[model samples]
Target: MKAAAYRLTKIKGKGMGLVAARDLKQGSLVVSELPVLFIPGKSNDLLVQEEFAKLHPKKQRQMMELFDVNSTHGGAKTPEGVFITNAYRCPLGNALFPTAARINHSCAPNLTMTHREDTQGRAMIRTACDVREGQELTLCYTDPWLCRQERHEYLERMYDFTCKCSTCSLTGEAMRESERRRERAAVLRVKVAQNLAMCLEHSTPEDLLTEVEEALDIARTELFCEPTIPLMSERAMVLALLCKKPELAQKYADETVRVRLVTEGGHKGLERFRQYAKCPSSHPGAMALGVGSLPAESPDLSAAGRVVPPCYSPMSVVPIEGKGMGVVATRHIIRGELILDEAPLLSLTQLDANLIGGSGASIGSLLLDKLQRISPAQRAAFWQLRETSDSDVGSAARASSIFMCNSTTGADDRMHVYLFGCRFRHNCVPNVLGLDTLSKKNHMRYRAMRDIEEGEEMTVAYVIDDHNFTMGKEELDTLLEQRRVSSCDCELCSLTGPALARSRRRRKKMQALYDESKNYYQPGQLPKLKELISLIEEDIQSPFLVADIHTMALFTALEDEPRSDAAGYHALEALKCKMLSEGDHMGLEQAKAWAERPALARGEKGSTCEYYKPLEFPYVDRDPDMPFAVALRQHEEDVQRQAEEAQQKKAAKKARSKSKKGGQKKKNKGRRH
Candidate 1:
């Protein structure tokens, strides 16, 4: 059964895959193998150059010792071209063995990936999913970040094949819809970033506490649009810590860490998140400490390498040279195996220089240069580890830009990323879930919708809610063009005129409603709150709703139980759920957060003064369409009636006083006469 790793067979152009040569059970072991290659991205570039130059003097000997690297992407019959055409490129100079590289390409896939260290102190891969016999195993051909054309091109140019995957099949309006979703996601990300920057900039510990109490509304709002994206929730927790609410920060941090670990496989990038969960105030990148002082931990990548096993595979969304890149199984992978161990090619510090070129040129080259410009010792050390730029200036810049754009670490300060997994192609719906395991413990796993056969393509979603809401055509065209894709075929690429019109109208209405609800919510009307709820419900069906369901739930609960700790905590779910039907971010921590504060009454009888200050921007008024206005009116009437009653009571007292005074004066005058 252990040798069943040989069960992977060939299907010609379909590439090598796992076949259910027989039936398999749950928790069964699939193919697993130790990786044939190892590449650590650690170096300032000088080091790689120094090492490489060492052999330059012995060209013949060096060529024989090192595997041939083919830069030519074409039809040359030269030995280098054939191998270059065949060599499966991975992180740094690492390449996968032919056993794993022979797999075919697919947009939809069956298996998931996970990696850990075995008793030998070496990283190992094990099955996280069940596989059946005779199923063709395939890997993703493009990174999730690439647009459709980029993916198609990558496969064709490098792998010499064109993709007929589901994502590639979608054309016209459907593609646009997918792009719209991506764009909306990007926009929401910006908004979240903006809010985080603001909080980190102005808010002090006291300010953080109060703002945390309030800004959670926005965090919850953004969660609806992208629940799995942990940045928003992480920021919200950061706010809590700023105000010395360690427990609240710890709670939210736990969630942020969990999501980062599960999806990203616990690389260093997720370590701070893990720490933040355990010790929110102390974790690096804790905004409460001032985003400046709290720094993200970045390690030098030179001379560091993680040995992967054959069973682990990678899924990607990044573009490759020529034919964009995609995910590929690194070995006859078990359900879980070490697909790829990777470190950041370049890490930008929090210093101002990091902002140079806007990540425009090859950051790998730029960074290496910076290291060289430092003191002689530092430059020499950097030079010793660095490798020359293999790409032209534009490509170098693009590569640098790509790295910077996609290089984000979770709350966990450690920088982490899987080389192979980073190559999985993009789709609105992904089958694999990334687990962050590098710095902290990662739980990378893949579940099969059904029995997976050998050589079958395994895929995970790049974006969520692909089935219902997709991107707009303009978005698709714009992004694809920028990424150098000919066009797009995502579900939302093209649409009928009516459908497009409807989509626009829905987006407009949702924005309008969101504004109205935000404004109307100021007085904290309880009964009238149902109006905002209804409006949100109506807007939920729209394709362009920027925030996610979790965000909506958090905001709703905040309104429902203002000044109450119970409700707020219930809605701060930072996890990325695969099942889209989730209504809200409900859980234990949220409940605790809400429970801690207890509820406070808004106003009482004869409470005529407006003691509450209106919230700042992005915390808009409540929906005008809701019953809030009428409820506010009713509350006002009740207050007015109480005022009248108080007035009458005071008038009676005044009259009695005047009468007593008059009687006393008359008696005195009579006595005097």
Candidate 2:
């Protein structure tokens, strides 16, 4: 009995089209009507004719009144032609909806259609986003991930006209960029499918999580909302079942349901997602994965608020003397306390170099394209960030520079620019431990490395590696210079006299021991590994490196005859270190499992533990005292020397051949005389 939200109208060049009857908010229902005639299986002339004859006389007339492009475009006025022109695919089969058939196609559509079985097999159309009055309602007819050319070809072949939708009407570089994004999206779609399949078999949960997060990033960037619903659902399932993080699982499930409601009114899986959101352990997959019915509670941050804004709350964005702006603690914060957890404003995955530059696409061009597509608020937030580039550069170049200066590698290995997270100033030795939380949540989490008082500025290491801990002050400065960092005034960087020398000596020894541990295990390596742990703990308070050292110690302990008690101890230490480095999750779970059961340390293949193995470090034989840049230049010189030597040999061989030939000619002339 409710009035229709849209009225049929003559669209300028597109014949009949649906236009909004009034201003409609997102998710508002535009049409819900049962089919006038429903045909089962693949529709053909005979099938359509049979279905049409079965329809009531009034219904038949109504269906016939609907626009038939096949007949109007010089094609035979057959019943099947009209059926193909106006029919919408339903759960049972192809169904002809008189009202819904009038909707036009747009590459960037504001409306979405779904078949609703709950409403007695009625076709439902809803606004994907807000629509103003008199706005033409449209839905994408072909695959949304298809490139513009492919889309146009399909539309022209299937329908009788070429699509001139707003997206298709784009010209020049803008159009090429759009096409590239679509092609990339399509490739990523296939990758996601393959990864999901692999996850069900040989792939680790972490690998699948990374792939899903990357796919979701592209989907969000491209405004491909429908694909995200399924991705979020999968993410929730994986977090709950495999990862055993119920709280995160619930969060994703809730998000999935919200997105589903907004995009497609509701899917059949809507109720299931709601259940998962309410109780993640209720899912059958959780039981199979041995996940217990744990309460879905967020990680306790104690006094820290669950969510803090970028501007203020737990931390205040304040002006530092040298640094333009930096985050400062507003209150006393305890060690391991969560300081801030924020999502990225912009994210980009690592594309192949060929793909990045093949089609005249650079990071700057891609960034500019992304900027233009983002919401006004997001764009404003991005622009508000510090721009270290020259002010006179073009917008694309400017965006690229801003991104380069502030972006950090996320847990998924994608580059992300966080509005608030990037505000924390960089220090060689920092007071805060910032990590991209290792989940599909894609949050940059900043935790306190040590307790701090109110008004203290929060700082994090811009880059963390063996170099940060092992390199001396001068070497550190050289490395930072290479990275384009201005300077560091952190406590360690400011050390003078004996304090500085001792720190350097300790780090040098640590680096030596670390490199030794990476090679084939030696007879007396256990003591050296223990020393490395002590050095790391004393000199640098980084739990990640500490965890790495502990893992090495565990490996050494496992190699011993009958595996000593030290193996279990080191396992426990590794677990504690991992917990500090990367909150409670699957990494902690594996470490706990190893710690609880030392027998598992022997590992199935007898080489190393099956659950955990240290990553291999490629050996680069360079002098310990040499700066990286100097070593690089020396390498280039060595390469040039080899090239020159090869050239000299070739020239000498040619000269000897010429001399021999001249001598042979002289001998022949002398003989003739």
Candidate 3:
């Protein structure tokens, strides 16, 4: 027999109530149970009765004893009433968890009855906070956010019980103070919403930082942190990145994960952030934080390297031959220039899901509310957005459709619909990069990767890895076809026949070489890294790919000597590659910083590397005579063979497509007669 952590006991006035058998820590599981009976959301009386009858008589009796139907209406004998009074609104529906239902309601509940599905599909109740032995466990029946009076009225009308918890029982000044704070929080929401927009669109980093700070202040004043923690965490990271403080950004990223664990609980949305937290440098521009200053000899490579020039603004929006409307250079924009810093017209995030679709409110209502708050000019700009084929037929749905279609998702899970940023056409091999300033909640910054001549069309990547330089041509084309975007006419995308085959072959060789060298930690591993570096150097067309390889090489080199100068060289090489290909401002700085002092990259002094483990490298544990070098060679040969096979298949597909097109044209000509 399974031993329970809690037991049901008769209380003086509250009928049967749950009492904790032992003390439990916060987040401890108190009960894991399946519902005795369930009424699939708002079922009719006949259906409810039929489901109830299907249950065993013993289980049915247990549920009936939990709630009294006669108390509401004398001798009515309503089984549905009994079930309704006791049922818990779980992920499934209204369910009668015999043990969970016995736990009485409180405005301030110690135990949070979350509807969590286990591997076996059983619903579990976990303690939100600590509960002492013999103390009565309670859960909130209605919204815990309601004011004292509102809670009283809600409880009276819905459950026919008056809440007398510590919060509800507060009297005099204490009660008034609590209510005042709640009112203040409600009022601050309008300002927070407005400022969030401003933060996204600010021209200067300082102004953007100011707006973010203001939002944080308001969130702190709210008293409850659950609603605003995610925003705060994201802002902290953005601030750190902007200020060139990677360590500080990492701290906030850790907090973001912690808060998500407590609130959202195992959400798939958190994985991207977790990866960022684990390796902040993996981000394109994140390396800039590592270096305090740019080298004197180094060309002004990014807007972050110096103050933005006055003329650096939206020069002109011009139509391209193949691509749609794109931002064009009016003057000679220097390498590492700030071309545009425009704010989003409309921004939507997962945080706004409830406000948009939950209960009485909707996306249209929320969009209207936000639209009304902004200036007339901003509203006009929003309306000017070119509606796509997916725009809804109706007004409300149309506004939502326009926003959704135009908006682009950022790292923080926000969808920002920009006025100017969206105009820049998509290119597989772009000369500029768009960076999300998470600190500002809803803003992105565009920086020049290289010097732009007058009349040149400025372009940014639509998908981060969806490019001929990064992904295979086939994969790139498939994604473009899905998005309904124009086929990329970039120099790299136009490769055909022998030229395309040669590029693919080089890329495959480089990939295989990288794979072979990345894992080995032996003394002989340096030779493999040298080979990989040589291959990367050979494929000089895409420096972005080279930078990533060099970064890996730098890490591998660091294992031999904690403060190896060789690692520093690789870092600088990687930085140069990144700057040339993607204008990675952060990567440039990080490389410079690492070159100056390699010790900082190695955790604290005397401490082991935080990012890598000795166990992962076989040299630390494996026998000295292990044939690590031979195995690596074998792996490289195998990878090369696979790459050759893949290339042959690709060639076959292209030939088939060409043959089909020629046949179709001939058939069409015959039909014209």
Candidate 4:
């Protein structure tokens, strides 16, 4: 009954069909309903029979009405032909809806059906274009751009009907002209896809703007309306963000929403673009590429090195004793001190799916284009990067290898070749740390994780995470050796003789302890964790691992109902370790919040967090040393007290109402006035 936008009517030669009840605009909701019958598999005659036999007589009759018993094409064989002709695919099955079954097919349809799960899994038919009153509502069973010959064959095979639509009925030169238009559109489609990929991977803001214009021109040539040309609107949004053009982004974002409503029924990515449209600068990648540079300060001299501009100083490029060139501190640098702030000279991203993994020509062109865009000085610096042992490689191979060795991937799947930053060589246990803070308006910056002596070559971990530390030593050594262009000569890697055996033994014991403690159920886990922490501290400066230990320690302390001070101390320790690691991930943020107010982080009596065993802790547990923690405990107490008072008042009022109702009922019964 809710599918009321159209009414069923008998149409000439087309059997029963749905016609628009009134004049309707494009993108207007026409009808939405759940399927009446559903079954798995395409040619499931058994399933149809079994399912039909179980249905009530009235439902059976309803299904019978949909199929013409007399006609060969109309379910005359087994009543399954009707379902085969009409049912659409859904999860685990094909679904048949009663009201929608009446809607006949058309090659040039005014309505389009989009299956949606957001509205409780209802399949919706919406107007693809404006429709006049009494006009038939139809949906094309195949792609509208299919050639006329193909459309005819597809329709005849699938639905037992020949298409006589406007495009299909054309003859002679008209038919040839339509085919030509389709052929041209198909060719342009590939070009448009390539352009979009290039824009995402290699184009500047200006290039994205050009793509938008070119796409619109192609769409116009193909006689595509605004709703049909989705890419033009999408590219405009991306271009707007890149150029910090919020208003333009919003305009295109809204257009995209409207177009999606007509064709796809909804767009899931709308929310992200909507937020970007509202404030383009709020996006993580907003204006990250080719923006104005930060102001440069004159080079400052320190004890052993000089800090230089654009690269930032007390840092200088120097050759290491056994390794290649690396960055070194001129002065003694304290922990957490910023080492350098630098942007890449050239950044490249992957090409589109169609262009990727083909001949190396497309990727080579992209690399050359990026090189040309940079300043001559920057280009010269990029060329000065040392050649590897491989020399017989071709131009494409050489370029790709250079990037593979020197470039680092950052946010947005971007591979950046830095003139200076890439010089900081790999150390499994390095003292320096590097991270891309694109959202913070700093593309990439390096900082000291520990105190650095003057004239020491600053190094960062090449494998950025703790995975290698977690692995067994032999496996880790094998994997690292395979990946290395040269031998790793770091303190841990260079060990040999009995010392190497002892080191491996300690690592094996440490990993075993770490594995046991990670489960939180091992006997003497606290003592074993202490031993693990001592081992890790002795081996390398892995603050990330320290942070995990402290986080685990906090939960372990709380579970034992230890003094809240000990819990708070563990929380603070974890927070400090995360800060030292220079990580701003969700885990670090949560740790920081927990350290600030331990009581709030702990669950309340009936809160949703109560069901989570990990979050369950005594709310009264408060660290007396932490003023904010004490304040949070007091606030929660007050809230709980207020909630109890409200409950009491409600109960009293209910009791009074019950007593008054009883007295009134007695008085109405003439027992007492």
- lDDT per residue for candidate 2 within 388-461, as digits (tens), equals 66653337666776776777877677878876677778787677888877574677777776667878988887
Candidate 3 global lDDT: 0.59
Best candidate according to lDDT: 2
Clashes of 1: 179
Cα lDDT of model 3 by residue, 350-425, tens digit: 7774444452237766777778776543565455454554544335655665565466777777777876677677
Residue-wise lDDT of candidate 1 within 1-673, one digit each (tens)?
2435326566664544555555544223344444333222222234333443444445424233322223324432432332344334332233333344444556443332333432211222222234466665444545533556777788776666678755567789987765554445444444344423333344454554454334344323322212233555565576666556677777777767654443334454454456556666554335213432322221111112221111122322222345343443322333222233333333454442354346544445655564444333222222222123344432445344344433334234433223233344444323333433333343222332222233434454433332233355566556544333445543333546888677567655545544544542243433333443344435332111222333344444455554553233322221112111211123333332322321212213222221233221111232222122222333457689999999999999999999999999999999999
Looking at model 4, report the run of 10 residues with the lowest lDDT sum.
290-299
Candidate lDDT (C-alpha), each: 0.40, 0.66, 0.59, 0.61
RMSD (Cα, Å) for all candidates, in order, is 33.5, 29.3, 27.8, 19.9
Residues 619-668, candidate 4: write the lDDT tens digits: 22222222222233345576899999999999999999999999999888
Question: What is the TM-score of candidate 4?
Answer: 0.42
Q: Distance from true position, residue 175, model 2, in Å?
A: 60
Q: Candidate 1, residue 641: CA error in Å?
A: 93
Which portions of model 3 miss their true places by more than 4 Å?
1-3, 39-44, 68-70, 73-77, 116-122, 186-252, 263-273, 279-673
Better of 1 and 4 by lDDT: 4
Stretches of candidate 1 off by over 4 Å are 1-6, 11-13, 19-83, 86-92, 108-138, 171-174, 183-275, 279-281, 287-673
Spell out the clash pairs found in candidate 2.
Answer: none
